[model samples]
Target: MTGGRSPRRAVAAADRTRQPTEVRRRLIVEAAVPLIAERGSSSVGVRDVAGAAGVSVGTVTYHFGSVQEILSEAMVLQIERYYAALSETADRATSAAGALRLLVDALFTEDTDRHWRMWFEYWNAGEHHLDPAFAGGQDRRYESWHRQIRALAERGVADGEFTCADLDGFTTRFAALADGLALQRLRQAPPLTTQDARRHLHRFIETELGPGPHGVGLGPAE
Candidate 1:
């Protein structure tokens, strides 16, 4: 045999050389996301993420600084993706009432179940742990969600599709109701189905905003 490195060793070296810094960072973060969702942010370790990402622990630390940083970034990434989807849904609505209905549908669907689970995991982590990054990210998520819902409420009022004397109060109440219903659907035995949650939320919206133009109501028909 010639004086050359083995094939496997050469391939490994090439792989390492070909991987870009940003690619490596994203791999680690993406790997961490599912782990955090499955096991909660507080439960995952740096080595676990590195192993899952097929990188060394040093590589994870190099990119994210710490497990907490990786967890925080993963949470932020999920929320950003979710907001993008919500914005897309909002863009397709024919009216503000339709927008609100579509938003509720988007939130409680099977596609969002993992996201809701991860969210509650983060909420639990926030209660027991004291990481400022995680806490700050959670707060920003709450504020962003509230801001979007409030904007939708304002639009409905402006279009005279809804009648609310206190927009902010209505937004807060609506958001709280959504959160509570989602939690119940996630945590309860004989869990609340998406249809059940939608019906409850639509009833609440009707109570808060009244019927839309020509008694069309604020949500889709059952």
Candidate 2:
């Protein structure tokens, strides 16, 4: 099954509707992410996802083989949406920093915010052993975020709008801050929105990379 066409490539909404295997497969996993998010992955089963997705238990087992398969698929399901949003926003971006801003905002959108919730749930549940899927997803996600931030810092330096003594160090610093901020917002719905996160980020960059290697002079500071 792993060697066969990946669900991602096979993911065709209209086409999925046309294929029973694809349709059941998609439903089973899509239903599983939230299940695992709300209930620990170990507690979630193929039957659970099938019931939630309104499909037969047999159908879920047929597509996923076991609870492990279902949970692993859920991991993929959670991150795929976030990456898709990032890619789409990046495509429309004119600047690297703008792309980074869009990436955070997209993840925090009211309807899409559950992925963040799901992430915390996964970690809290110690799900890696159960799912064994998307093993490097967190590292990959951080790398992508850091790459964008570094590019933005470089661009600011080039445009004389920002400065940074060490691009790599600053990127890591901000990525850590972004995560802490995301977690805070998730647990407590801070006064800060994703917009606030980006605004603070922009201000931080201005300080690190702006005039005299600091300060955006962005006028009446927030």
Candidate 3:
């Protein structure tokens, strides 16, 4: 063997050493998401995130000031992913009512259980730890969610698919109902099923929004 590294190997080494700081920071955040999901934010540490991200503890600290910061960033990333997917799926619906139906279906399904778990964990961490960043992020995220609901409701009203005059009131109540039902489903204290949550949401929609222009009733939940 030669005494020097090959050209390709040397380029690869250079690339690793020259990796962009922001990209490396994002990698650490991405890796920390699942860990936070699996083990709450209070339990995760810089070393654990470093191991998960396959980087040194110093590397993680170089990007974030503390484990709390890393977890906060990870929570923000997860929330973005969650809302992005929901928006994408809702966009595929042809009508406002259809979009609302699709959102309820997507939100209460077994597929979103992990996402709900992470969200609840993040909320708890923010409240118990008194993290201003986390609290502000949570408020911003919920406001976005409420805006999404308001937009859909406005579209429905404009299209003559719904007859609700109090859009703001409806949006607030709808969001609160969904959050309460989701918490019940997550805790299983009352043994709420996905189907139960979906049906409850749909019923609320029918009651508040008038079941669209076709008088569509809340049938069996899928």
Best-fitting candidate, scored by lDDT: 3
At residue 23, give the lDDT of candidate 3. Answer: 76
Best-to-worst order by TM-score is 3, 1, 2
Give candidate 1's whole-model lDDT. Answer: 0.77
Error of 3 at 121 (Å): 2.3
| TM-scores, one per candidate | 0.84, 0.70, 0.85
Candidate 2 structure quality by residue, lDDT tens digits, 115-206 = 76666655554444543334566557557767766876676566655456798988888777766766876666656676676566655554
**Which regions of candidate 1 deviate over 4 angstroms?**
1-16, 128-134, 212-222
Per-prediction tally of clashes: 0, 4, 0
Q: Specify the poorest-scoring 10-residue window by lDDT in model 2.
A: 1-10
Answer with 2 or 3, whichever has the higher TM-score.
Answer: 3
Model 2 spans > 4 angstroms off: 1-18, 37-43, 122-127, 130-133, 189-199, 212-222
1-222: candidate 3 lDDT, tens digit per residue = 112221121123345476799878887898888877766777778777877776777888888988878888898899899999999988998888888899999898887877887888878877765767668878899999999999988888777776787899999999999888888987899999998898889888888876456534333334
How far in Å is the alpha carbon of 144 misplaced in model 2? 2.7
CA lDDT, every model vs. true structure? 0.77, 0.62, 0.80
